[model samples]
Target: MAHSQTEEESDKMGQFDWFGSIGATPEAVRVLNDQPILFTILLIVLVAIILQCVLLWYIHYATLKPEQKVKKEKKKPAKK
Candidate 1:
């Protein structure tokens, strides 16, 4: 007699395959599943740091002195 597929096995293969498809290791996926809150906080902190850096750069750029443009004088036409 042939062995039957279990519902749990079918569900695991259908949805969770994406983790492996995306190159996430089993351990990493397990960690993410196990501690989503910790990872969420860590992600928020990382984004905040990046945003702070970007704002600082924008501030520095905005405070820079404007470049002075030289005006060109048009030459007068010679007398006929």
Candidate 2:
């Protein structure tokens, strides 16, 4: 029996071939893709900023100024 090469295997190898690249290796690409630590850190940072903005907006526009309201009430009685 003789070994035969198939067109599909040849195409797959060609697709994955990065034979003449400079600076970056397959190991580096594999390591970068496999690790999720950097992604997780970025996600946490984004969530924190979003939460901070939400809290800031709540404090800016949602809270009532009880002291100012009381002062207006006092002045209104004196004016009448």
Candidate 3:
């Protein structure tokens, strides 16, 4: 069976550009494509760092110590 020129061109066009068009730079895309393992590890590390920061903030603010709670209550003026 023989394929038409347009069909062949269309097939070629359908191939994904490893370097995406507008958002990601070609160099960044190439690095990600080339080193998927490194990318995954880095992504995981970034997420863990973000989660750690959020967890620390939550621990500090969401669950106040008894002494800190007393200080906050003392700071607020009582309504007449």
Candidate 4:
């Protein structure tokens, strides 16, 4: 027995355009599809590098001591 699609299913299928509906051009989608593994690796590396830099900056900033101002005492003149 063969199953048939209903009107709603047909309409939903008709409205689907893989690239256009997702807002990406066909060429962009094609490129991503072709190099999915490479893109995934690059994205992971980029995020790791960014996180490392942020953590390093936070550590450095946390270890820093704010400078304190030194107040000098006024010298009084001795009376003869």
Using lDDT, give the best candidate's number.
1
CA displacement after TM-score superposition, residue 40 of candidate 4 (Å): 0.6
lDDT of 3 by residue, 49-79 (tens): 9999999999888799776765543567779
Q: Please list the residue runs of candidate 2 whose C-alpha ends up more than 4 Å from where it truly belongs after superposition.
A: 1-31, 64-80
The Cα error of candidate 1 at residue 67, in Å, is 2.9
What's each prediction's TM-score?
0.54, 0.39, 0.46, 0.43
Index of the highest-TM-score prediction: 1
- Ranked candidates, highest TM-score first: 1, 3, 4, 2
Higher-lDDT candidate of 1 and 2: 1
Looking at model 1, residue 29 earns an lDDT score of 66
* Count: clashes, candidate 4: 0
TM-score: which is higher, 1 or 4?
Answer: 1
Quantify all predictions' global Cα lDDT against the true fold: 0.70, 0.58, 0.68, 0.66
- Residue-level lDDT tens digits of model 4 in 17-78: 36556697755655666667766787899999999999998888777776533458899998
Q: Which stretches of candidate 1 lie over 4 Å from their true place?
A: 1-17, 68-80
